[model samples]
Target chain A: MSLTLETNLEDPDAIYEKLIAMLESHEPEKALRASARLVLLLINHIGDRKVIDEAIERAALLTEA
Target chain B: MNVETGKAAWRETIPVWRAFEPSPKPETEFEQARVVIVGTGPVGLAMAIDLGQRGHEVIVLGRFDFVPAGSKAICFSKRSLDILDRLGCGEQAVEKGVSWNIGKVFWKDRSDPVYKFDLLPVKNQKMPGFINIQQYHMEDILLDRLKQLPNVQIRWGHEVTALDTSEESAIMSVDCADGAYRIETEWLIACDGNKSSVRDLMGLDFEGRIFEDNFLIADVKMKEDRPSERWFWFDPPFNPGQSVLLHKQPDDVWRIDFQLGWNIDREACIKPENVNPLVRAMLGDDVEFEEEWYSVYTFQCRRMQHFWHGRVIFAGDSAHLVSPFGARGCNGGFADIDNLGWKLDLVLEGKAPFDILESYDSEAIVTADENILNSTRSTDFLTPKSDISRAFRDAVLDLAEDHPFARALVNSGRLSTAISYPDSSLSTADADVWSGGIAPGSPALDAPLDNGWLLEKLGGRFVLLTTTPFADLPSGLDVLDIAQEPANGLLRERYDLQGGGAYLIRPDQYVAARFRQPTGAAIADALARAMGEQA
Candidate 1:
C-alpha cells in the first residue's frame, strides 16, 4: 500500500497545533524522546509495515530542506 | 629565496607574485563606462570576458595588483568548466588540472574505503565530473583571456572607496595606487569576495550560520604514484576523533585538509613544525614532500537577502558563501556570473527589459540556497553535534560497510553540480508532456556530437534545439537541428527526442521551454518570456 500524502485528518490544523504544543511542553532532550515515543505509538496504531516504512522514508526526505 | 624565513618558504615552490602597477588616470575627471565590475577574481574575470566577447566595453577594478598565491578552491565542478569553456579556457584548465570522477570515503582505520562512488556515473560528457586546479591558475587563465579582449580594461590597484547608486546608473569613488577617481556606469557588479567593501559601502550583510569548526588546508608538492581521486576519512588513525580530506592537484600538489575541533590555537596549527607531523602520520615517513601553502579556514554558509540593490549588483563571494567541503565556494561564484552575464548583457544592449535582471537575482539565490543547504548538511554529517548524533553517524558507517541502503545515507559533501532553477519566473511552464528529459529551467546536459560537443554549440546565445526542421523561427533564435548533424544516439536519448521534440535554450544554456511539437507562436512566446517581456 502507498503512503497517503494528502491529509485525511478531521482537523489537520488542530492536530498540528496539538503536536507543537506537546513538543513545546518538554525540555529539548525530553521533547526529542517524547516525539520518538509519539512516532512509535502512531506507527503501531497504523500497523501496516509497508505504509509505515513509506511514511518513515517520506519523513526522512522532508527533513532534507 | 631561502627556506630559513618561515613566512616566504612556500613562495619558492608556488607561483611567483607580481608587483601591483597602478592604472593610469582617466582622460576625463569623471569617466563613464557601460559596465563596471569590482574585483578581479574568477567570477569577475569571467564576467568581463563574457561581456567583452559580446563587444561590450567592460572595466574591471581590482584591489590587488597580482593574483594571490595559494591552492585555494581546488575543485572546479563540471558546470564551472562548461562556463569556462564558453569564455574560451576550459581545455587549458582541464589540461593543467587533475580530473577526478571517483571519491572514496573511509570510516575508522579501514584499509579499504567503506564507501566508493562515481561522481559522473554516466560518462562521455564534454568535461570531467570535477577538475582540481589552483584558484590562482584559474585566475591566470581568465586574466590571459581578458587581456586578449581590448574592450575589457583591467585596472589594478583600484579599490572602491564608496558607492552611490540611482535608478539609471551607479557611481563609485575608486582609490587607486596613483590617485583617486570616480566612475559612473550603467551597471555595477561586485565580486569582491566575502569581506567585500562594496557590500559594506552599500550597508549590506550576509545572513546565515557559521559552522563551529576549523579545517587546516595543507597543499604540498610531492611525487606520488597514487591515482587522482578524492579520499575522505572519518576518525582516521592519523587524526583521531576528526576528519581528513585528500585531493590530488596539478604539478604534483596534493590538497590535504584536516578538521580541527572548534577550540584550538589557529596560528600555531599552521606552523610547519606542527603541521609536518600530521602530514608524516598520514603519508608515512618514506614519502618526501615540500609545503606549497598552508591555511586554516572556518567556513560559513551565508548570503545576502537580495543579490541586487538598485543598479548595483553583487555576485560570487560578495553575494553568497558556503563551506569548502562541497567545493561550492568558487563553483557557486562561477554559477552566479553564468546566470548574470547574459542577463546584464541583454540589459546593456537594450534588447531586454530591466526587470529581466531581477530573474538573475532570484535564480542565483536559488542556487545559493541549494549550495548552502547541501554544504550545511555535509558539515552536520562530518561534525556531529552531540553524543547521540555521533552514535547515529557511527552506526550508519557500520551498516554502510555491509549494506548499500546505509551507504546511500552517507553525506561526505554532496559534491557540487549544476543547480536547476525549476521555479524561475523566466522559464515557460511545459504545455507538452514527456516521460524523461531536461525539464524547463534546467541547465542543458552536455553530450558528444559528431564534431565538438553539445554545450559548445549552445553557449553565448538563445538557441532552439529541434529534431525536425522549422520553416519559420524567431529572428534572434538560432536553431540546432538534430537531423543536420551526423548521428549521435546520446543526443536523442539524453533529450528524450525518440518521439521528436524541441527545446528553446537561454543564453546561459538553460532550458527555457520544451515542446513535443513546434508552433511559431509558442516558440515566440517562450522566447519573449525568457527575456522577461510581457507575455
Candidate 2:
C-alpha cells in the first residue's frame, strides 16, 4: 500500500479490514495484540469509546503481556 | 422433547434429538421444513438448531468440516444464557466461557481503578456470570445438539447466492461452490453477516449511519504477567490524550489495541518492532513478546429498515450491527435465534398462524435500540470528540474516585449491563408503579420458578405468572410466582400492585409485566402483543 501514516488519517474501515485479515490469517497472539492498534485508530477516526473499548478488550488477550 | 434427568446440562436436558426426524415430502410446502437455515453462525446455525429442536423439520446449510478460529460468542449475559439453556446450549456455553467478576479501569499512566459487578445479586442469572466462548465452538455445540433432533438436515457448502423469498412461500435459489440447485420453501431467514448476499439480492434498505472509528485488532504471544481482569487505560484519560486497552484470551494469547487518536498507517502501527514500545509502556519496560497477527478495521452502528421483508427475515449482523464495545453485534443475533425458533416451529407445524413472524420486527427493533443505541451513547461519553465532550468524560471518570455510584456507572458500561427494553410492547403491563425483585415486565432470572424449575421452564413459549400466593396459571402459558415485598417502591410503582404482584415472560424471557394478583388478563395482553399476527 502506498499510503503513509499522514495519508491514512481518513480511512478507519480499510485499517480495520487489513487488521481483521491479519487476525483471521495470523497467529493468535499477534492477532490479539493488534486489537489495541485497531482500537486506537478507531478512537482517532471515529472517537467512539465503545469501539475503542472493544478493540482494547481484544488486545489484552494476547498472552498476558 | 424431555429435559434430561439428574444434574443433566442444557444440551442433555433438551430433547431436540427426537425433533430432527426426517419427514416425508407432503402436498403443501409448509409440510416440509418451510425454512432451511444455512451455517449456524450465531444467526444461521442458531436458526437451524432452535427450529430443528423445536420440531420444524428445518434444514441447515454449512460444512462442519472447517474448524473455526477463536470462540466468537465470548460474552453472553444471564438473559442470553437463559435463552440458550431453553434451547439446550446453555450449560455447555456457560461451561466453555470464563466467568469474569472484576474489571480494571486504567487511564494510561494513572492509578488503576477497580470495579466489581455482582451478577449473583440478580435472581435468575446464575454461575458463569458472563461467557466468552469462540463463535465457531458454540456453533459446533449447537449443531451437535441439532443432530440429536431427527428432522433437521444440514447442507454443507450450501452458499446461498440467489434467494427467491419473493413469493409467499419463497423459494431460495442457491449456488454452492460445488454445484447448484433451486429449493422451494415457505419462508427465508437470513442469518448472514453484514455484507449479506441474501439481504442484497432482496434490495432491502439497511438504514443507519456507519460510525467514523476504524479499529485494528491483533493477537500476540506476550511474556508479561497480567491479571485476567480486563484493563482499560485512557490516555490523557485524566486529561486529553490517546487511549490503550489490553486483554487476555485463552492460549497464552493477548489482544491489544491503541486508540490511534489519529488515523495512521496500518502497516506502521503493526510493524513488528513498532509494537514493542507500546507493549513496554503497557506491560513494563522489560516485558518480552512475540507477534502473532495484526490488522485494522472501522466501525458502523447500523440496523436494517426492516428486519423482516416478506418471508425473508434477517438476523445477526444482517439485521443489525452494533458497536463491539458491548459485544452486542454477535449477542443480538443470538436473540434472533431465540425469538424465531419456537414461533417458526409453531407455524411450520400449523400450531399457530404464520403472522407470528411479525413479532421479530418489534422485538428485534426494540432490543437493538435499547441495547445497541444505549451502547453508542456510552461510547460517545468515554471516547468523546471536541474539547467539551472530552472534558465531560474526564469529569465522569474522575467521579470514580469518590462516588461509588459513579464507579458503578463506569463499570456497568464496561460490563455491558445497562441494556433494558421496558418500552418494548412485547414487555407490557396495565398502569402500575415499580418495586423490589422485578416488576411484571422483566427478563427471567436464574433463580427458581415454581415446580422445581427456574428460568429454564419458560423457554419454548410466552408465559405469564402470578405473584400472590397462588398457582392459578393460565393454561398454555408458562407462569411464575412473584411475592412482592411490601416496602419496595420500585416494585410497587412497576406493577401498580398495592402489595402483591405477578409477572409474565416471553419465550425470549423478557418480562411482559407485573400484576397485583390478577395476572391472567395482563398476561393475555402481553401474549397478544407477542402473538400479534402469529396468534
Could you report the Cα RMSD, in angstroms, for every candidate shown? 7.1, 14.8
Model 1, B116-137: lDDT tens per residue?
8898876889999999988888
Cα-based lDDT for every prediction: 0.88, 0.59
List of chain B TM-scores, one per candidate:
0.96, 0.80
Which lDDT value does model 2 have at B105? 72
| Tens digit per residue, CA lDDT, model 2, B214-263 | 55565667765666556666663422376555556554667765666446
Residue A41 CA displacement from its true place in model 1, Å: 18
Runs in model 1 with CA error above 4 Å?
Answer: A1-65, B1-16
State TM-scores per candidate: 0.88, 0.72
> What local lDDT score does residue B514 receive in model 2, on the 0 to 100 scale?
56
DockQ for every model comes to 0.06, 0.02
